[model samples]
Target: MTRTLFALNPGLDRPAIAAALRAHGRVQVRQFLHPDAAESIHEVLSRGTDWGLAWAATGKSGAHIRGPELRAMTPDARARFGLEAGQSASKGDFGFLYAQYPMVEAYVQGWNPGHPLDLLLEHLNAEPMLGFARDVSGIAEIIKADAQATLYAPGHFLTVHDDTVVEEGRRLAYVLSLARDWRPDWGGHLNFIDDDGDTIEGFIPRFNALNLFTVPMRHNVGAVPPFAPVGRFSITGWFRDK
Candidate 1:
């Protein structure tokens, strides 16, 4: 049986997290942005490539893959990352379900400077909810971003990865972890792996927890349900620029 998740708390911050994360590079964890962020992002997603959100459940020959894909703008900003509308080649094993939503590049080019996305960006850049992106490109820098949803069930896992690309010169990824009532045993832990991926050092995900870190390292999410019966859900985002 599937278990219903509890609502996420909008405000979450461990008093010591700020100081601790700074030692590593950067870090923050809090409730995800409002449903407005999720709903509004959905509006933008409609313009992206489409596939049934449930495509993960169906086999490669599944019914969802045969469905129509939505078309969205290919922002010049996203092109730099070698991203393209409807491109699934780069997203990895999670790519199948991840492919349906168009992923945009967010380094060199720019996002819609005046949209709500920008509003959030402005607020975050100046003063994030938990930690601060205070260093220049010297130590770490942060950009702005948005991401859509995907479906992952039991046995599904988002492999650990890092955001730092030396050539890309982008460091630090700040995410607002959305979704709630995630049990430790539900097995959807966003394991923060060390450079080797052999050990889990830290994690900050729960209702209202915010996660911030340097990128291009290596990390992965723990396995999903079936080991447990709860499906995981979250709307997340990152901050980066260099």
Candidate 2:
């Protein structure tokens, strides 16, 4: 694959996407990026990114375990951490366990100086991608966005919660999937749950699909089954007004 700047498809149906957002508060744009661009992006996530562990347990405010620390952990230590996180979830705590590359944080700290992921973050925050987000969501004053690369391996999950942060200025949450050939039984789907604890809708991870939804909606990334052979790869974050 050639090293190239990321580009939007230019042929997206903005009006249709906008309409769907208005009706359902969410929409999935399939083939969201140009084919070549999509392939290039998948290559970055699949082979280029150095993933880290992102997990949370009760009373733990710091969630990220950066790549270096993750690499230093023994297999037993990693499993112990996972077990603790699982235990927290079983006890009704808000917790999540997934591999993450904190894009915005990395860009700020120069973690991988001059990497494409940094450039990708810039592409998301600048035009025409920024402008496109405004047009589709009808949420003007969306000045920026923050992102993180995520890989949900077997047993990784995000528990149900509404994305509500008053200080964060988050208007909508988005996910761009790089996962392909994912099976339904693998169980890493994004599900919207109702107040009654029932799933109202769910979206499977599909290659090159962009899933966007209004914030403050109850949702969770379902836990992957142990028998699953692949990770659910995606770049996810929120569109913000700040």
Candidate 3:
């Protein structure tokens, strides 16, 4: 998966992604592939990440997943890296996954990577994921890249919430779905709340699909399932710091 994704695009999609998030609350960016990228990424997530005991009481969750020398892991691959499972902030029924890549800690913290991170960066820059800051929040040009993965099981839900708290130049909130060829009977949809915190803009969560939205708005994922065994898997992250 990681290898395929890396081979698909290479890096992030700045303009298109920005437009999608700005217009539709989220966007699904395509990924390129590399031979062993996916398997290696999963290995890092499963054992290399050092989740420690903090994740025991909680589930796999974090703020930064993509950074320099970083690779996003897959479900089957994460077992080797040490994956954690936990409920959403508002709802406990729906569980999510989390892990962090410290190699890019410096990049997410402050250092600028050059231009906006896109799929094109990997082969081009010394750090493919490194790029200029451009999301929302408007503060520092470069900020920490806080990202993570989320999986929602049956009867699980993430009550509406927003992702804009850190002050940075265009803070980014994104989610990439991993579940493939699934039916709607599967629960776990991200609902974007309007300004009044009522009404929904959309409920998106497609495979390899990336949704980027500015913070400050309310949103959530879930609604349990009346069907059989169908869950939601994706990676959610924000470009910011504590």
Clash numbers, per candidate: 27, 0, 58
Q: State the lDDT at 21 in candidate 1.
A: 64
lDDT of 2 by residue, 1-242 (tens): 47555788888999999999999998889989988878888888889999999998788853888888988989998887688788889998888899999999999999999998999999999878889999999899799999999999999999888888989999999999888898899998989999999999899999989999999899999999899999999999999997
lDDT of 3 by residue, 1-242 (tens): 32332333456556666566667655546542242543333333433433311122134443333433233555564443223333334343323333332333434554434312222223222233324334322334444454443445554455555654544533566665555555656756667767766656555556555555666657776555747375455545665434
Pick by lDDT: which candidate is best?
2
How much lDDT does each candidate structure score? 0.44, 0.90, 0.46
Strongest candidate by TM-score: 2
Residue 173 of model 1, lDDT score = 57
Q: Could you report the Cα RMSD, in angstroms, for every candidate shown?
A: 10.2, 1.2, 9.3
Of the pair 2 and 3, which is ahead by TM-score? 2
Error of 2 at 113 (Å): 1.1
Q: Cα RMSD for candidate 1?
A: 10.2
- For candidate 2, the per-residue lDDT at 7 reads 81
